[model samples]
Target: MHKRMAMLAFIILVVAWGIPSAKAACSTPVVNASFGSVTSFAVNSTASTSSGSLSVNCGSSLATIFNTDTISVRLTASTFASGTQAIMKKVGDSSGDNIPITVCLSVQNCGSPMTIGAPATTFNSTQLSIFLLTGGKNFTIPLFFSTQPGQTVAAGTYTTTLSFLTNWDICTGLGVGIGGIQICVIDQNGSATLSLTVTLEVTNDCTTILAPAVNFGTAPLLSSFSSVVQTISVTCTKGSVYTVGLNDGIHAVNGVRNMASGSNLIRYDIYQSTTNNRWGSSIASQRWSSTNATSVSTNQLIRNYNYTATLLSGQTTPVEGNYSDTITVDLSF
Candidate 1:
């Protein structure tokens, strides 16, 4: 009686090994499409980028009975998406400040991306794998992203959320008779939504500076030389406080700026205000400041600094030749 009971139990275990398991389910996504701390000028000058992956996993159900599974992720705009492209806006800002962006699978050129709320585009090609090896076909879709250029936005964090759809085919190998192995046990429509949080950061800074050329044109004598005024235009991040400094000219002697003509020096000075004080490269020398006490509210706030270059009266007249000197301009924040 004991031998018969052991044989019956062994037969039951063999039958259970051949039976199919339950259907497969994928893991929920936690993704972020983040471009950390990008300057406003960087986003405007070129594409700012961030990336995250979308993954798929089917259950391990008897590799002997299954060949390999194929998968294709389709990127479609979600329910909350409105435009034909993804747009990020400043968090908690209701003034409608937005930055348009795009996502791509290939890094060659993000030229063509799927529309935000239109037909679906395949995120990746058919992912092929052997069912027995590499359990659940461990794979991750390579997502590339870029923000559209030419945006002059305020300094802060910008954010948006995008949606996607994924489709997969879980196949089974049934027979080794006709054409080797046959495909069977298709999925009963597998799909999932991915909410991709896109974020960007803009820091307060001075972006651009347009220095002026002070042309003290053609003065035959020292006393006849007139003061020349020129403007320095500066573009900075909105609300950022900054200062501009000008170094003494390349040709100088005893703290006095000089224009050199073949070692013949002519004295001159550059002042922030008309005869107030010479503009030198130091905070103590009183660099031009962007703000007094209030924030600059405009985007790419351009401030103009007018300076006067006067030929000093004490210097004797030099020979008849062209004299020029170069001064270095710097920005501090």
Candidate 2:
């Protein structure tokens, strides 16, 4: 009877120990790992304005150690494992309490509190994906901004840094242990800027006054007249040249338009040559010159032979006729 009792006690003790061992075997192993390398991460400015997502793969090394669907890692906003999670954050510099940007993180392949397991052992074969949580989709969550009104940011390289921590709960027969993974979140910002240029051109206004036609009625015989000055006034571009017309019958006497007249009715000055009225000789003349309006060293009329005169008394005669002359002026740079 005593031997049987001792045997029974022994069996009970073995079963108690076995129960705990069985529970330990079923629990998942703990794993804390990094991205394996401090590789570069990229963010596109032109990409969706909302926060983006990425995958931090647990290559073969981390896969084999914790090899179970229950084994997993999670990201937190806090710098340390125990700190509060980093929910949505601004990715850039901010004038207020936080930086000027907003950043959010998520599991690309699974939701938060997710589990990871591998079907293969190769480094490339193992994978995990993280994405923005609620507002991560193209137009779901909005990207906050406090941009200066009426002003656009210049194009350049803008970099933002984010600190992250990943942790896992590893189960052992005795208790649970915590492990941590360190990660860096970097955002590369890009943009395009534009500049505008305007050009204007100006021109000059051309103006001129031509010689006036003169008429003389019948006058005293042997009439004569003093010379008339032809003037040209430049109203626009300075130092420009103008051309004037002249002929043998009408000549320019030192920039003057002079015409000789006869005083008698039969000896009257005729604008045009006539053989019968030769008792007195008749003559006509015109002149021309040019100058810049602004720096007119000598003031001159733009009109060719702007003014003229005729005699109509004794020693002067009136010439009857619609006397007229043509003048041409051209401007050239």
> RMSD, each candidate, Å?
7.1, 26.3
List TM-score per model, in order: 0.65, 0.23
Each model's lDDT comes to: 0.67, 0.26
Off by over 4 Å in 2: 1-196, 203-211, 214-218, 238-323, 329-333
Instruction: List, residue by residue over 114-133, the lDDT tens digit for candidate 1.
Output: 67644554432233432123
| Cα deviation of 182, candidate 2, in Å | 24
- Per-residue alpha-carbon lDDT of candidate 2 for residues 1-333, written as tens digits (9 for 90 to 100): 888767755664565466542322121112221111110111111211223222222211111122112122222223211123222122242321111222222322222231112121111112221211232111111112111112112112232222322222222122211233321111111111111111111122344433343344333333433323234334432233443323323432443333433321322222212122211112212223343122243322222223232332443334653333333433433
Q: How many residue pairs clash in each candidate at the backbone level?
A: 0, 43
In angstroms, give how far residue 201 of model 1 lies from its true place.
5.0
RMSD of 1: 7.1
* Highest-lDDT candidate: 1
Give the 10-residue window scoring lowest on summed lDDT in candidate 1: 123-132
For model 1, name the residue pairs that clash. Answer: none
